[model samples]
Target: MKRTWFTHPEPLDTTTANELIQRYTSRQIQTKKTLAFDPKFWLVSALLPEYRHEPKPSKQYQNSIWSQ
Candidate 1:
């Protein structure tokens, strides 16, 4: 990816590049962590008989999980 991107003439300044890399790395790390409030997990739980009363999947619910 870096090699291909290097083919482009436009270059990001050092501070901007570092900030971008940092944000990307932070997101990658966050995605790797287990999130208890994740809506997808709750949806599966809701499907189970024991958790039938759990809230249904909605845009707000899913977004809440991913936004973390």
Candidate 2:
């Protein structure tokens, strides 16, 4: 099945985005009971000015943290 986020181009409203962010930060998956990673953490954090800090690791770093 195609992902809604991919099939649709509209960005989520602030309220929805914040809810998703909170769910991720708290490690509470509202959609399902199983724990899963949320890629939106970085995306939403980046849009907010207060979330300043070192950026998330790149794909290369994610693949091999010890190599570089």
**Model number with the top lDDT:** 2
> Which prediction has the highest TM-score against the true structure?
1
Across 1-68, the per-residue lDDT of candidate 1 in tens digits comes to 11111111234444544454566466552111122343232111111123335576777546666788
Write down the lDDT that model 2 would get. Answer: 0.41
C-alpha lDDT of all candidate models, in order: 0.35, 0.41
Tens digits of lDDT, candidate 2, 1-68: 22222111234554666676677557642231212245332233322223445678667535465658
Question: What are the root-mean-square deviations of the candidates from the true structure over C-alphas?
Answer: 19.8, 14.3
Q: Can you list the residue pairs that collide in candidate 2?
A: none
- TM-scores, all candidates, are 0.28, 0.28
Scanning candidate 1 in windows of ten residues, the lowest lDDT window is: 40-49
Give candidate 2 misplaced runs (Cα > 4 Å). 1-10, 28-68
In candidate 1, residue 68 scores what lDDT?
A: 88
